[model samples]
Target: ENIYLNGAILGMRKREINRKFDEIVDFSGCARYIDTPVKRYSSGMTVRLGFAVAAFLEPEILVVDEVLAVGDAEFQKKAIGKMQDVSRNEGRTVLFVSHNMAAVRKLCNKGILLENGQLFASGEVSDILSLYQTRSIEKIKSKKIIENEKLGNAEFRVLSIDAISPEGSVLSIESGVKIQLEFENNIENKNIAISIFIVTLEDLILFEAPIIFSSDNNSQKGKYLIEWDIQPFLLNSGTYKINLLVGESQKYIVYKKDDILTFEIENALFDQGLNLNRLPGVMRPKVDFKISSL
Candidate 1:
C-alpha cells in the first residue's frame, strides 16, 4: 500500500516506503501478516491495510470513499474511531462518504450533499441528513407500489397502499393528508384489528393508531378500502415510511407489512420566502406558545 501511495504504482518506490509500510502494519493490526503476499489477503484485510496506510501517513488531507464498509462491524467502528482521533489530536481533515446515516451522523460535523454531480446542499451534518432523507422519499413518490405481500396463509392481503394529497397528486405530502389502504379479507364474520404506523425510514415508529373492526365483524369476505387521516400534520420535514398491520385482537398476526409505503413531507412553512426546512426534531407542530411572569 505504501509503495503504491508513494508512486510505486509507476514501478518506482519512495526511499522510505518500507518504514511507512511497517508503521501501517502495526497500526492496522496486520503485523502478523507482514511476510504474506498481498494477493493472499482477504478483502477485509486489504481494505483495513489500505485505510491504515492512508490514515497513518499523516497526510494533510485524507480522502476515503465507502471502502470502510467492506470491513466487519467491529473494524468499521475502530476505523471511525481512528478517524475521529486523527481529527481531534492530529488536526487533519478526513473526507468520507457513506450511505450509513448513523455513521455519518456520528463521524462528521459538516456535510455536503450532491445530486447528479451537482451541488445540492452543504451545511451542518444534521441538516444535510434531513435534506437527504427528504429527497430519498420524494423519489419513491413516483412509484405505485413500493411493496406487495401476503402473510399468515393468505388469510388477508394488502392490495395497495398510497399516500395521496387532496389535489390527487402523490408527489408531495402537505399538512392534513390521508393514507388510503385497500386490502382483501378472505375470512367472513371474523373481527380484525387494523393498525397504521408512521415510522421514519430508519424504522423508528413515531405515530401509531389502532382501529377495531368489531362493528364490521359480520361483513362479507371481499375487498375493502380504508382511509386514515393525519390531520394537523405534526411531522417535521423528512422521509418516513408507513406500516400497515391487521390481526385478530392485535395479537394473532394475520398480515403485517412494514415499509409498504413511503412518503416525503415538504417544508411548507416558510419565513419571508425563505425555506424553514431545517426545523429541529422529528415533528413540527403549529401550537400556541405563551410566557407570563409569575
Candidate 2:
C-alpha cells in the first residue's frame, strides 16, 4: 500500500502496487475497501487509508501533518493509539504536527515552540506550554501604547494603543473589552482611514476592522481616540497580536505596524466539561448543537 501511494515518486509498476495494497489491507483491517477507488474516498477515509498505508511501511521514521484532524472522533482516537503503539513497541520515530494542543499534550512527550518560522524553544510538553503562556501574558500586560513616530507621515502619527476592560479596569479577556487607538493628526480637515487586524500567534488573521473617513465632516487638528468594542467575542483562549494601518485611503498607506500589540485569553470553563482554552482552532463562536436518537 505504501508503494501504491508512492508509485509516482518511486516509479513502481501496477502489479507491485496491487501486491503491496493487499498486504496493507490485511494489516490495517481495511479489507472492505480493497477495490474502492481512491478518488471516491471521503476526507476521513482518505486520512485513515493514508495513515494505515504509512504505518504498514515499517519505516524507521514517520512524518505526519494535520491529516489526523480530518477523521471523526473515533477514527482520530484509533490513529493516535496506533501511533503510540508504533512508537513504543516498534521503536520507530514519529513526527506529528498539529494545532490541537490537547492532542499534542496527550500524544507527545516533548514539544517545540516555533516563532516567525524559526525555532524558539524545545523542552518537555508542559514546560513548553507554560513558557508560551507566561511569555504571552507578560508581553500583553506590559504594553500600553507603541510609540512609532517613524511609521507616521507628516499628517498623522500613532501616540498610543491599549486594550481596556469593560468595567473600567485592567484589560481581561472575559466578555466585554475594547481596544483604544490613540493618534495625533497634525494636518486638520483631512479624512484618514484606519485599518486594524487581530492576528493569532501563528500569524493568522482572525478578524479585521476598518474605519473609513467621511468627507461630509470637517474636524480640527488634534489627538483622536478610536475604540473597538468587542462584545460577545468568540476568540479562543490563546495569545494574539494586533496590526494597524493608517492612510488617506485603503490603497495609500501612511503608517503601518505589524504585531504592535499583544493579548492573552485565559482558559474559560463552561458547562458540560467544555474548556474554551482547550478547544482547537483560532476562534470558537457560540454554537448550537442538537442530538437525538433517530
Candidate 3:
C-alpha cells in the first residue's frame, strides 16, 4: 500500500481539480474553440475578458499579476470579487501581486514580499504589508526630496509636507491642530490637479484633499502653499502617516513622496485593559454593556 502511494503518477494529486464537477456537469457538447486567435485588444478589454474567463475556468491554483489595473474601476471590483469566490467556494489557492496595499490586505491571508530581486519576507499578509510600508517610508525619508512629473506630462516637484503635533494631545479631542504641507513646485502648467492625503499607521487614509490653482482654460505658474486644520481627528492611540498625491482627479496617483511619514498619537488611560478591550479580540470600538433576556 505504501509503495503504490509513493511511486505513482497519481502522487495523491490530479492536474484537473474540477474533474469531478465536470463529469457530473451536462456539457451537451457545447465546448469548441475557434483557431483564429484575437491578436489585438485594448489593455482594458483584455483584462475584462481574461478575468472573466479565468473566473469560470475554475483551476486548482490561480495566479494573478498586477494586470488587474488594466480594467476600469467597476471591472476591478468584479475581478477581485471573482478571485475571492474561487478561493472560498472552490477551495483553491490564489497568488496575487499588487502595489495597492489596501487591496492586498483585503484579499490575501498570506503574502510574499520581494525587495531588490530577493525574497524579503513571506507570511501573514498583515505583517508583510506592515514591513513593506515601513521600508518604503524609510526610503522616502532618506531622499529628503520629493519629485512629481505626472502632472500632465510635465514636472511638478513637491519639496516637503511637514506634519505637526503638540505634546500630550489626543488627536480626536483636538478639533483643529495645524498641519502643514510645504511644497516646492514650478506650477507652470495648471493642466492637472495636485492632491494630498493623511493616512493612519495601518495605511488607512483618514483624509484626502486637493488643490487646483488653475482656471479659465489657461495655465498658471509659480511655487505653491497649502495648509489645513484637522477637524475631529478621530484616531485611537497609535501612529499616523502622511501620503502625498498628484495627477488627474479620476486617475490620480503617487507623487514625490512615494511612502508615508510617521506621527504618534497619545491617548489617556482608562479602566480598560492594555492595547485593546479587556474582553477579547483585536479591536476596542466604544461600547457599553447591558444585561438583557429574551
Model 2 misplaced regions, further than 4 Å: 1-58, 62-91, 96-109, 113-126, 133-151, 170-173, 186-190, 267-294
Models 1 onward score TM values of 0.55, 0.56, 0.57
**Candidate with the larger lDDT of 1 and 2:** 1
lDDT (10s digit) by residue, model 3, range 162-210: 5554432544333324466655544454445666676754456666777
| lDDT (C-alpha) at residue 88 in model 2 | 87
Those runs of model 3 whose alpha carbons end farther than 4 Å from true positions after fitting are 1-37, 145-161, 166-177, 181-196, 199-227, 235-294
The CA lDDT of each predicted structure is 0.73, 0.70, 0.55
Best first by TM-score, ranked: 3, 2, 1
Positional deviation of residue 152's Cα in model 3 after best superposition, in angstroms: 18
TM-score of 1: 0.55
Best by lDDT: 1
- In model 3, pairs of residues that clash are 159-184
Worst 10 residues of 2 by lDDT: 140-149
On TM-score, the stronger of 1 and 3 is 3
- What TM-score should be assigned to candidate 2? 0.56
